[model samples]
Target: MSIQITTLDSGLRVASEFMPNIETVALGVWFDVGTRNELPKQNGIAHLLEHMLFKGTSRRTALQISEEIENVGGHTNAYTSRDLTAYYARVMHQDTELAIDLLADLIQNSTFDATELEREKQVIIQEINLSRDTPDDIIFDYMQMAAYGNQPLGMSILGKPEVIAKISGADLKKYAGIHYCAPKTVIAVAGRVDHAQLLDWVKKYFGQLSPVSDAPIPPSVYKPENILINKDSEQAHLSLALPACGGKDPDYYAYSIYATLLGGGSSSRLFQEVREKRGLAYTVSAFLSNVDDTGLLGIYVGTAPGEVAKLAEVLREQLVDSSRNIKKAELDRAKQQLKAGMLMALEQPFSRAENTAQHLLTFGRVLSVAELIEKIDNVTPADIHRIVGKMISAKPALAGIGPKKSMKVWEKFELT
Candidate 1:
């Protein structure tokens, strides 16, 4: 069935996909405000606010919120990302109204208590420290810094420890007021849902939200950078990135196909070349991150310090080779893999609901199952070749963490 959407008079979007076969529903409130929406100094406010929502609301304490949901056999959680923050719940079909009302209460009635804010501040500080202690996790942050410099686009979603410490309750409330308005919010529900009821709940709970008048954010530049971190570590962590197509760009599908063929799994070129055949690394994969107007084509590999040099060479070689040497069979397999993954994701209510909300925010509408498949099918070997060449021709950005000797070798992978 088609996903239904309604925009309340207040500008909040209500979207729903009804799957009749199941008796469970996944629903969420998705907001466009994220780390990038913050001021330079308020890096972690978006994420902190996400945590604060669960701590308390006007009518329910944090424990009551959890107890009520659990008593009904439902699970509720939230996450903050670079572009959006989502609070979602999976509940039995009969509890759809309850889910939407709960989400509404969290988003609109949260008081951002001062004491809760202090405790969450320390918790986020520890979260930051934990990421730093994990080499592979922290290397991505360093890679992002190298790729886009200090812009919000490049900054860590978790924010810096120092900045997190200084983030006060006033900061959280003020940021939320400006960004969590009707114009910036979406409520998406999938599975055993009624579009009419969802719309009604939205109007009842969110119809009063006033739209904020904030200035639009300008596009972020993708500047190339390279950083080699010397640390004592058992394994070397490496991330190499090149500029690529954005989320809404025409080449998005082609770039995705090429990335999958490169290192998506055990059957991929990078895995076969770097891990299976040579046994250089246990973990190696390619990733594509696409924001509103910018994107990155990147690879991450974790291996023993001694094997960093060899893995780097193989990665560079495979990337260069893929632009021209990609065969029809490899392209076909990648297409199938991507198509299957897409179809499987649609079968899940959470993925469907999340996609609906995110798509409405990103493209103003959700792509139908046929629409997504057709786009993925339209990608040809020539398209892959063209985008691969275009993406890799730019100077690559590199981030690595290892002993000094391994990092010295890491610096040698640059094309220039």
Candidate 2:
């Protein structure tokens, strides 16, 4: 029921949250460099490195890495995002050492074989193809491009097939050497654990990392524009976005509450108005995203091609209405929802570890549940109104995938 943080001499941040009742622990090595750290030619190198690391390490073969974890009744997984990359595992408390060693090996001793690197490129190309086939998924990629132009932050993490095809084993090693150093990395653990023992384990295995490594990431610039993709799909997947605050901004919590009340769940405004009352779309939701220096408040919907115009009209009205007509009841409901979700995550070791790593990287400290709840509770109706009003004032970037005829429908839709 307590959290402890320590900085090793190598500049690595080891953060752990102790839960006395749990029998399992979750731990991970999180690196702050991701897609944004890549050069334009090396678009998907971060994700490619993630796959290559698991292919094999100097101490163990690919099969050995998987077998060792599964044999102990534990599992390991990793993901690469726009801002961070994580390799984590869940295991019984007694197997914590094995998990830590396996993670350490992947980062410090990986031997990116040439044969494996070539195979992984094809695998990622297939992944890219699969994503393209998914309309709802790919629309977001298009929306990102429209939002931030051709910059690193706006690029898809999976990368383009042509770009990935040219990346070699040397590229993976070079990228890792640059970004996987002590200064930008965090070793986060949660659940039943001893903080002192955890630090000892980290020092033994991760002591080799260089304490100083420069992270030169290009700044992200938000440029709102429109994008349209014509496909023979049955429904139109549409996304709209407006600039918002970064994760450290004072208004971050207020923006979170604003998005929740807008379309976080079935009871929220977008779901009730678009799906229940008018029956215009099957899936509709709003999300808030906060990156390093910028963020977005976005709304997404999938509807029949013929209903695009009506959907746009209703969205405009709802966006405007939320600013002026938000009631105390709605604000209270959103606050409770945020608080409940935050508290529930505390019981999940994996979620707790993930949030802990992210909080440290973003805010340079872990936020207490009390502090988070107070922030959520302090968001007044006026805060919501102010956030909504500011969001609506900016021109929105619109992205869609559907029939060609619907292109004109989306082109004419405006929400500024």
Clashes of 2: 0
Candidate 2 local Cα displacement, residue 220, angstroms: 1.1
CA deviation > 4 Å runs, candidate 1: none
RMSD of each: 1.3, 1.0
Give the number of the best model, judged by TM-score.
Answer: 2
Error of 2 at 86 (Å): 0.4
lDDT of 2 at 390: 88
Structural RMSD, model 1? 1.3
lDDT of 1 by residue, 141-240 (tens): 8888889887888888998778888888777777878888888888899999889977877777775466664647556788978888899888999998
lDDT of each candidate versus the true structure: 0.86, 0.90
Query: What residue pairs clash in candidate 1, if any at all?
Result: none
**Candidate 1 has what TM-score?**
0.97
Q: Model 1, poorest ten-residue lDDT window? A: 206-215
